[model samples]
Target chain A: MMVVIWGVVKFIVLLVLLSVYVLFMTWFDRKVIARMQNRVGPKLIGFHGLWQPLADTIKSFWKEDSIPRGSYRFLFWLAPIIFTTCAFAISFVVPFAPPIKIAGGVLHFSVVNINVAVLFVFAFLGLASFGVLFAGIASGGSKYPYIGSQREGAQMISYEIILALTLLNPILMSQSLNFETIVAAQTHHLWYAFYQPVAFVCYLIAMFAVSAKVPFDLPEAESEICCGYFVEYSGMKMGLFPFAQYIVLLVMSAIMVLMFLGGWTGPFWSGGFIAGFIWYWVKVAFFVFLFTWAWGTLPRYRYDQLMDIGWKILLPISVLNIFWTGFALSAHLPFF
Target chain B: MTQIVFFILSLGTIIGALGTILCKNAYYSAMWMISTFVSMAGLFVMLNAPFVAMLQIIVYAGAIAILILFVMMLMDRRVLNNKERFNPQYFWGIILGVGLFSDLAVLAFKFRINITNAGKSLTLHGSNTKMVGDVLFKHYLFPFEIIAIILLIALIGAIVLTKKDEEEAR
Candidate 1:
């Protein structure tokens, strides 16, 4: 009963955190990008537009919802909900810290500590592609959205294998699929990043690909497809679409921290709940910052280039890394 | 609570299955199939198979379903126009489905299932993953290797079929 209650409380907290993160990330992206272009961004409403994300949220909520004629109404509406919910739910199993002793001596973490938490996160992330595909198809648009959806679907599917294989390296090192076990393993030795550099790089590339960031942002390729799959979306609908993207970003960063960064492991701090929480956030924020920085520095890849990097470069490397990790583990070598 | 979850799961799976057959557009059908896959996975979790449930979502719902959807898109079939013709087949499909369901129901009623009332909940034993791996590599080794070889052959065959045809056309 305590576990159930803790789960509910954690779910609520995580949802609120994700909602705020999504809103602010949008504002941050806009402001950062604008500054890069030597212009002030979102400076109108609140102190250099600090309140920009909130304002945008309100505007989206108030905007008239429009459904395209001949669109499949059920699927069109269902897409965003599935997309956002799956994005939100994966965080439930992810440990933000060591379990906390709460009222009545109930032990709790951010979410349920499933044994297969790592795999669950990947599985949920994989579901997000369906939302994009459904959104494109249900729009009943010309060939452009279809083309965009096709690209997005193919890109996601291809990158997903690499992501899983890259993740397998750390899982092999820890000899467990549980997120908590992976973190606990890291406390004894160096982080998995030291040994699995190839996997780390592959994961980083795949993360960018999955997030549809610069170079891999083929789904929303401007100049050619015009916002690509989301061209037809408007008002709160578009807001939901970007909201899902931010959630994906947060979840991906969180997973990266858990799998590679020795989640919540810091010097001088005992592996308590508060310590774990701080470490988890710090690592996630660093990665999020890295994602923003990459957005500024990197140019978008050509469609063919993006596909080539995914299939030709990252996929093979990840496969090789998996084998190497497996061999190292079997031979009792210090792989991590 | 379990019943409530089961109800929701069944509703989702049934609606998704119906949508797969009833929808005019192939893309929409594929989306519904994905929904069915995900909901079925939830059922698997409810049955205490979290690993299998995750695999179902990751492999089938994630990779395989999307692959099918992509192939459907690539084929560019005029799905909306063909709905009228496909409607007649649905009646036969439903009859066959009902017949199978009833047969399974009768079989299930006839069978006596013996379940041990273990006082303890199912817990994963230490090195369970290793045990599974050992079984796969030892007893099932030949079959595993054969499957890998078969997959490789099929992959090569596909590459030959697609690549050579494109070259010949060029």
Candidate 2:
């Protein structure tokens, strides 16, 4: 019973932390993008628009709720719910810091640490695409939204292969799927990124594609499909799509850090939980910033170019990298 | 708690399967099928096969269902609604259903249905993912390679079939 209570408490804390992170991340994204474009963004609200996301949330709540005619009302209501749930579900397995020794037992920073956590994260990612598909299908049989969902489905399938293959390099080297084990393995040797540079680069590129950020944001291409699957969504229903997206960005960034960046362990010193917690977030923040940075700098890839990059380039390279990593590990090659 | 979870998942699986068949819309049918897949994954997890459960979600609910949904999107609703109620395929469906039911019935009656340590050999010391990896790469290496080769052949065949002819392209 105590254990259950502790688990619930930890989950609530994580929820609060995630909400705060998302709120600030929106501000950070806007500010960074604005600076890149040589303009000030949301400066009037709080300190550099720190409170703007909160204001936006309140405003969205007050807006009139509208459902399109001929829409599947039940599914239209359920789509964002599914998306947001799956998005938050990915974070459940990501360890924020190393487990800390307490009075009676150890306390893990993550919500849950299942054995097949790597696969679990990817599974949720796959399931989240369903939410996008449902939104498109439930939107009164609209052409644009349907096209957007189709693009999302294709993009997800293409990039997921690359994402899985790239991450397999680290998993192979570590010989474990658990985040804690992977991070622990890194502590003993150099980070996987230093050895598996190919996988790291591929993962970085695939990360942008999987998260549907700029360059690969073809699913939600503003000019082309007009915000894609969520074109018919309005009010908080609309808000939920980006809400889920920001969480995905944070979770993917966290996974990248955990897998490749030697999660929570500082380069100079492997410190206590307090220091490790700070180190972990700092790394995660860099990746989060990188997402917005890419958003600001890069132009959207044409649909054909997106497919070409995912299939023709990234897929072959990642598959080869996996084979190379496996051979190197077995051969006891130096720096593996 | 375990019983409650099992009951919920089992109920969900039944409802999803029923919905898949009963839904008039192809899109809703696909969604219901996905729900069934997810519930089955939960059941797999309860059976201590987390790896298989995750694979089920990733492969079936994620990839295959999306492909089915895409195909269904191109289909006209008028054509779908105009379809005959009864079909010749029902004969095959009944045969398959009865065969599966009898197989399950025989297993239940003969084996007494207690299945502890059913997958012990496949999951010894390490987690099931590791055990599965060891089995695939070490014990069943040749079969694994053969499967990979078959998949590669299929992939190539798909490309060949889909590719535009040179004369048509010109």
Candidate 3:
């Protein structure tokens, strides 16, 4: 019963948080890109276009949802829901703030504090690619979406290995699979990032690739594929894809904070729930801003280049990082 | 209640196993396989092996399913049209599968395995995870190290197989 109730509450909270994050991510992307281009962006809706995302959301809700004729109607409808649900579910084990006291004095941080939190996150994120593949096949588009889906599938599989191996560094250091316990371990010493900088770099690169962010967004390279897997979607149906993207970003950032940056272990201002929440959000926002900056600076990679980087560069580096981390741990190094 | 949950999960596993054999499309077959893995994981949890259950979900359902999907993506779509060759073999496979399943069912029903009434609480001190870790590092350390070495060799072999052959040819 507690599990069911907590699952429901977490679902609602994630839905609301993801919606708000998607809204602001749009605003941030547009505003940042516009500033780069030396032009104004969405200054009409409210003060400096603060309400622009809200307006856009309302407009999308009212727009007609179209299904292309002869498409696989069932998979088409099921794709986004499956994708978004998996993306949202990855947050169940991710601790956002320190444990908070509820009405009955019961303490909880995450919805599901399972032992294998890190593995669960990667597994769910990997499942999310199905949404893209199914959407592409269901679109009844020519060969482009199929090709795009293939590319996306391959890219995700390649990077997922690196992502898992990179995370193994911290898991090895902490010697625990629970996200909260990992964070608690970091508090006793220095952050994992300090000792495992190479792993951190590999993790950051893999995160971008897994999330399909800039330089690795070849799946939906606008110039080539014209929205790729979601070419046929419009209005609210199309909106769910970006919404899932925002949720992925949020979840990945939260994982990074927990695994590497010492989640909820910042300098104490008041040493309460509010302080922990503030620090958590601050770290997440900083990473999100870094992603935004990446979007503005980097050009998308070619398909072969992306694969080469994953298989050749990132995978080797991550393996080496694991060895280095193990050696350091055994040597009783003062780095962390 | 536990019996009801086990019955439902076993039913799901059987249905999904049948679906994997019966489905025409390879993608659909993969999805059914995933469903079977998930249901099997549920059975693992019911047997008080949460770590094993989670591993079932993570490694098999997650990683292996995705790998199969990748293989499916690489296959020629025209191969899916060759249904005539698959029908006979699929029938035989299902017959053998059901026969094995029933034998296992009979064995499971006959045997009464004793589960020690230890490590039932959720305390962090002596949970299954801690015990498993301790046993793994202490008693089974050499085998664990051997497994790591084997995995490393497999990784290198994969890299070599997938590498370009131009330099070797020269």
**Chain B TM per candidate, please?**
0.74, 0.82, 0.75
- For residues B68-99, could you state the per-residue lDDT of candidate 1 as single tens digits? 87776676456543656375567887799999
* Candidate 1 residue A92 C-alpha distance from true site, Å: 2.0
Q: How good is the docking of model 1, as DockQ?
A: 0.59
Cα deviation of A118 in candidate 2 (Å)?
A: 0.4
Docking quality category of candidate 1 according to DockQ thresholds: medium
Off by over 4 Å in 2: B81-86, B106-126, B162-164, B168-170
TM-score of every prediction relative to native? 0.90, 0.94, 0.88
Question: Can you write out model 3's per-residue Cα lDDT over B54-137, one digit (the tens) per residue?
Answer: 778778877778777767666765575355536556778778978998998888668853334222323433237667778899
**lDDT tens string, model 1, A269-324?**
75667777887788899888888888877888888888888888888888877888
Assess candidate 2 and give its lDDT: 0.88
* Tens digits of per-residue lDDT for model 2, A11-96: 89988998888888888888898999999988887877788999999999999998999888888998999999999899888887
- Using TM-score as the measure, what is the rank order of every candidate, best first? 2, 1, 3
Cand. 3 TM to true fold: 0.88
> Ten consecutive residues with minimal summed lDDT in candidate 1 chain A?
A101-110
List candidate 1 stretches off by more than 4 Å: A101-108, A267-275, A334-336, B77-80, B83-99, B112-134, B165-167
Question: What's the TM for model 1?
Answer: 0.90
Residue B20 displacement (Å), model 1:
2.1
Of the two candidates 2 and 3, the one with more favorable lDDT, higher being better, is 2
